[model samples]
Target: MVNSTTGNRKHFIYTLAATTLFISTYYLLLPVLPLYMQGMGGSKFKIGLIMGLFSASSLFLRPLAGQASDLKGPVKIMKWTILLYFITPFFYMTHSFVLVSIAQLFYGFTIGAFTISSATVITTSVPLEKVGQAIGIHSIALILAKGLAPTLGTLVHTVWGLYPLIAITVLFSFAALLVTWRLPEIKPASKPGDITFRQVLTYRMVWVCSLVLLSVTLTFGTIMTMLPLLALERNISQYSLFFTVNTLAVVATRLFTGRQDRLTQEALIAVSLLLIFLAVMLVSGSYSLITLIIAAIIYGLGYGAVYPALSTLVVLRTPSEIRGSAFGLFTAAFDIGVTLGSVWGGFSEYLGFKTIYFLASFSPVIGLICFVVFLHGENVWNKILMRNAAK
Candidate 1:
């Protein structure tokens, strides 16, 4: 079932540019955002609560966003989310913790809608053979933003103050909105009335995939929310460098690997999770910048490989008509992970940083087991059942 739907190349280009700009700004602010809250007299728990609540809002809204994308097409959702991106930075400038948390909540909504709709637009526009490659390309935009945003954000804050960084981010957000406004909207095959939640839920793999992704994302959450604070306490001056190195490794792996469809889906996922398992274990013991860099590289390798692989699997597993909902569900799972990880990191602080990171290492083990148990033998199970009935 290879499709020749390659004519939307220009629209694809526009989507990429728009998403990259928006995400770069968001990510640029992300590493130091918690620090901003702390400056406003917010404790780590309060900081985690704000971050968690944003993701929690995203977790709930993604399904509706996905359904909307499936019915009316991705354009409307994209427009609304980008507008949120454009407006949120103003709220961040308010210098009030409540206002900043509210802004972060808006960001959560932006993430849920944009990620699902944009991914749907990309995966559905390509041929099946190229889906994996397209996803890798789609991710490179974020990976590039991820690589540069932290170091740049941190450096900006270090040299000037937080206000200048917020100002630059707002500019990027507005630019993102402008670029996205000019793109053509492509409609899905079915009418809005025809879209239903059942369409997305019928495929059991969606559930399996989301669950596994959630578990793996827990590890990511811990790193993003906890690592900066931990490194600071340990007297590591360049914590942002850890993010820079991690993101660069992710970008390099995706670019160098080129095509990710060479191995079976499960095999690739298994290897990626195993790499993460090792990386987190390494992180738990890291005491120096060099040790963290080694851990970051390994983490990047796994993250770079697994995200696209998981996305490609979801696209292939679900039907085109309901694909937006599927992407929504998938992204929702991801948001949920980020939410819980932030809260967990905050709470785990009492457990001591080293012990907490050591505990976080086991999340991958649980995730890998879920992937194998749920996804690995359904076809064979069906065949065996059918044979027994015939006998």
Candidate 2:
């Protein structure tokens, strides 16, 4: 038991470290890319198109990535994908939106594969009883990178310029590649190609959860694509601080609720959705840094808990043989939401940021309603899963 515990701890730390490093490469560009594209003669819609391409490509790759995770060890997918991160940054040096679009596509593929594999590692390898806490802790890596790297990226861009920022991003991706080498590659229980993506998606809860995740991710996608531009327009100079504050709030909330019983999933998910709705509404009305930070805190609180809770619900009920496929479909929903959010940025040229934000705020509300109306209750969801698992 002592040895197993020690090994789990080691696996956990390695996964977190690799993820933080890998994701930081992308987050570094998240805030800077909008401004960069705008400077390069891209309009708001064009900029959004380019930005959305990242998640669009990620959305396409998720199923293949998920399947690969189930067939081979996750570590193989992780290592090769991180290498794409290292190489793809060079494409951005061309300063062409076409090339930038190409780079974004590569990035989408890399992140989709890396994240699914890393998540598979955590969900499958960890003790089943502790999956909730493990997932919550695993999320900290994303939150940490999302918080700190944008600030650092913006700072690096300000001090040095775009080329240096790209170089720094390359360095981080390489570091992630190295760390991933240390991650243990636990084999999935299923034999190679035994499970199909169709089998996973056919499960009602999987697609339902995916749609619910999509609604929230749409809000997040809009925020990621638009918030920097919004802050710039309003003269909120320290806009990156929004990410930092949001990160802290998410981390705090995850820590507090990470150990809760899975039986309370419905309540946890509903409350999380409500908090996210309120946060988006706040952003639509904010004109100052303080308001943005406040919105971040609320958004963090809601966004932080919903993902892990929803994910835990799916994985707990899934059979071990197809967990990878289910997660692949589930996370692909995230990519769709983000893609839609980015596409919404195209409409900004017509609607303007405040109006766009105001409209986007309803996404989480839709998700909440879906959860309540479609899910009906936890008992219904569980029965569905239990029946499927038996087959």
Candidate 3:
């Protein structure tokens, strides 16, 4: 029993390390990729497509990956997926816009698989009661990596150029692969039986969670796809500061509120969305970098709290047998949101970036309204279940 406990601890540590490394490299690539595409003579439309392409591919592939994880075990899938990830940055070194876009498709598949697998492993390995805290800590590591990566990537790109940046990214990917090597296998609880994609599709909670994820992703997609361009158009050269401030705010808030036992998932979601709405409003009204930075900080706090809360809710709501599928569906729904936001933002260039922000600002309110109307019943039921179970 002691050996089993120690092994689980080691697995958790390794999983966290692997996830952090992978996320850091992924975030580092995100801000710079559009710039790189533009430098390679790609147009804004092309850049938007390139950005959307990753999500697009992931949207389609995630279900397959999830199914595979359940069939083949998460550890096997993670091992192969991480190796695929390790090969991705090398293609970026070719400096071909078309090739780079194709590479992003592969990148998406590998990442989507790796992420679903890791989540499956973690959910299965961690104790049910501690899942929230474990996932929160895991999220913090990923967020910290995201916060630090872009700044470091920007500096690397500025000083060392594309090839060197590619080298660095590849190195980080390799590190993630190495860390994942230590993760224990997670066997699926469900045997080869009557499970069907149609059955998973029919669950109402799945759709509810998916819609919520979509709304949040739509907001983030607008920020990711347009913020730098908006800054450039307005002659605000310190655009990276917005990212830095946003990341720092997220990191700080996650640390402070992450361990709190009293903060229910619903409460976190409600507060986070309200703050996000305010931040988006601030950003839409801002004409200067200072105001934008301030808004970014607020936005970060809101966004950071959101994922952990929503993730916990989804996992807790899902049965262990189908959790992998649920997460895959969640990921796919987010991609759909990203696709919508990117396409919408692109068209909104005719209406102006501020208009895009305005639209994005209202999306979370829609999500909040939907949750209140639809998901609150589930929350009430869950509370009743807990009360009864405790007796």
Largest TM-score belongs to which candidate?
2
For each candidate, what is the lDDT?
A: 0.80, 0.85, 0.77
Error of 1 at 236 (Å): 0.9
Candidate 1 backbone clash number: 0
User: Highest lDDT: which candidate?
Assistant: 2
Q: Could you list the CA RMSD of all candidates, in the order they appear?
A: 3.1, 2.3, 4.1
What value of lDDT does candidate 3 attain over all alpha carbons? 0.77
lDDT, candidate 1, 1-391, per-residue tens: 1234444776677778878888778678777888887788887777778768768888999988898888878877788888767668888888787788788888888867887887777776777678887788888887777678878988898889888999988888788788878777776646767777765766677877888889888888888877877887888778788888898889888875546563566687898899998998888888889989999999999988888888878888778888888888888998888888888888754677788778888888899998888766768765765786699
Candidate 1's TM-score reads 0.92
When summed lDDT is taken over every stretch of 10 residues in candidate 2, the lowest stretch is 1-10
**What pairs collide in candidate 2?**
none
How does each model score on TM-score?
0.92, 0.95, 0.90
Model 3 Cα lDDT, one tens digit per residue, 1-391: 1114877888877887888887677678777887787788876677877788878888899987877777778888888987877667767887787778788888878877878888777777778877777767777776677677777877888888878887877888889888887776676656665456875765556777688778888877777777777777878777778878988888777766654442476788888888888898887777789998999899999988887777777787778877788778877887788777766666544778888888788988998899778765876766766786699
Give model 2's clash tally.
0
Candidate 1: lDDT over CA atoms?
0.80
* Candidate 3: residue 69 Cα off by (Å): 1.7
